[model samples]
Target: MSSIPSPTLSAPSPRVNEGMSQGTPACPSSCDHFDLDYTRQEDVRTVVETMMTAHQTYHNRMHAYFKKFPSKEAALLKPHPDTTKEQWKELCDLFTSEAFMKQSEQNKKNRSKLTVNHAAGSRSFQCTRACMKNQESSNINPVELYKKNYTNKDGIWTSEGAREIYRQCDLEGKTYTEIEVYSEILGKKSGYVRGLGRAVKPPPSSTLTTQSSDLQHQLAKARDEIEAMRVAREKDLQEFAKKQAEMEATLRDHREEQWVEQERIRLEQEERMKMEQEHMRVEHDERMQKEQEHMRKEQERLPVEISKKLEKKMSSVMEKKMNDMSKRLFSQFGGSKK
Candidate 1:
């Protein structure tokens, strides 16, 4: 049986290496190199799982925000307030893609089937292993690491499956390496290492010298990408600041215009009220003058009417007295003649 080749100096220790024949089941290159620490935690599983959770949450939030728009076209036209136009357009395309939708649905189905959840809050397995190595001065066995991550402080297994796997993988005086035991139980997975987080890429299946060269190249590429991203971020921040200032200035100008318009309307209303009051005062004065003129004419007509009535009554009384005096004189003369 052909033995597996030793990894580079940067790779994990030989204890984690799979010593199976070429035909036999073997773990990925990432499983062998436990040296690379992707997270602060020694527990690789917890860190990987936490990262997965955060990635899913970010996508979910983005999808939810995307749904707020009427359509993908509309979303693309109006990018998110926090993100740049290019970033928003890319996200819009991703969210609307059929492949992404299918993957999201499949992920939902897989999540629904899960029965037991890990008790570790945000803590990871890498951190746990680091702590153990610090205390024991030796690399922690894979089985022990699994138990520590799954089980509570009381040493009870988290689930029946976990307990069964632990019992089966327990060396128990047998001659099986911890890596072999884990590979047999967990089975082989493509791409990322089984326990390690996705952030850690699997080493290439090549010579040690070639692997070292490739790693150096990858590191250089990553640095370049990081620098580019930093520059882009700075530019985006400057643009965002400029846009914010412009928006504030526009809003301030709009408010000032509105204030001026309102003041003009208020002044016009005040002037109209004053004009109406003056007109009312003028009309009231004219009415008072007309009333005074009518009262004076009534006074003059009343004296004239009273004087005419008295003269007519006196003339009628004098005529009746003259008739009586004439009749009395005629009667006295007739009696003397007789």
Candidate 2:
């Protein structure tokens, strides 16, 4: 039997001259240089580009092969597209809208941190306003109340649980703003009412009962004192208001008197101005009349002076004409005698 021979591969064409330019000598026919990779590189972009080129070549070849053959069974064997275009578009739109809403809400919350609850764990730890106010009125520190009521086995306080315990407790005197600061400081120092953790055992039931009774008595006493103070404050306010009314009346009367005096002074000033104006007018008229009379006299004197000047001119002209005529007649008689 005859053995089939493998095909021989040719080297790059001499016309290409790429190897010659690089000064690389051509190899012998016996040498197997084809198995070796002479231009391998570790560059990531180069590797990726190589892979993309191979994938594209393979895809084009497969596409052409499939188009030529047109096999229904092979087409069925391939996986279908993950989703339709319309479905994909709808999902992207939904995600965009939801993500935008979430971002907007976060930005809004960041902009307006309205309450103390904006602090971490503060919502579940800080006492309610009403509870704080009540405890503050009773001269009980908020921190102490937090410890007595909310502290669990682990020595942590929860704001939600404190409300029920606060209801059973009694109240007393007026509360001030400073009380809250004091309570917060005490709570911090005690290290009991930490935000968002379990607390240890609270006060015993018997102690709570005793405290409630004492608080009740104190509350009644405080109420009576507050009532008396309110009555006294009301009386003082009424007296002050009455005095203010009287002072306002005096001020109004004083203002009216000032206005009347000002009006009188203004009227006198106008009268003085009017008289001065009238005197000035009379003076001006007299001066104008004198000036007119002087002008009339000057006009009367000017005509006579003008007539005298004209008579002088006429006499000089007549005399010169008579002299000329006499000279002419004498010259004529003399010529005739000669």
Best by lDDT, which number? 1
Q: Model 1: per-residue lDDT, tens digit, 1-338?
A: 12223322233345443232232233323334545443323346546665777788777777888989899998888777778999888899898789998998998899777654444544544445544443444555667767776788798877887777767778464554444443444333544433334443344445966988888788778888988999999999999999999999999999999999999999999999999999999999999999999989988888888878777777777777777777777778877899
Q: Which stretches in model 2 have alpha-carbon errors above 4 Å?
A: 1-227, 318-338
* lDDT of candidate 2 over 1-338, digit per residue (tens): 12222222223244324443565444212122222222332133334544675676654444444344345344434422553555444433443466755975796788675321212222233233223323234244544545544545465544443543343332433343433333333233232223211121122247877997798688777887888898999999999999999999999999999999999999999999999999999999999998898888889878888878877777777787778877788789877999
User: How high is the CA lDDT of each candidate model?
Assistant: 0.66, 0.49
Worst 10 residues of 2 by lDDT: 195-204
Rate residue 152 of model 1 by lDDT: 88
Off by over 4 Å in 1: 1-206, 316-338
Clashes per prediction? Answer: 11, 8
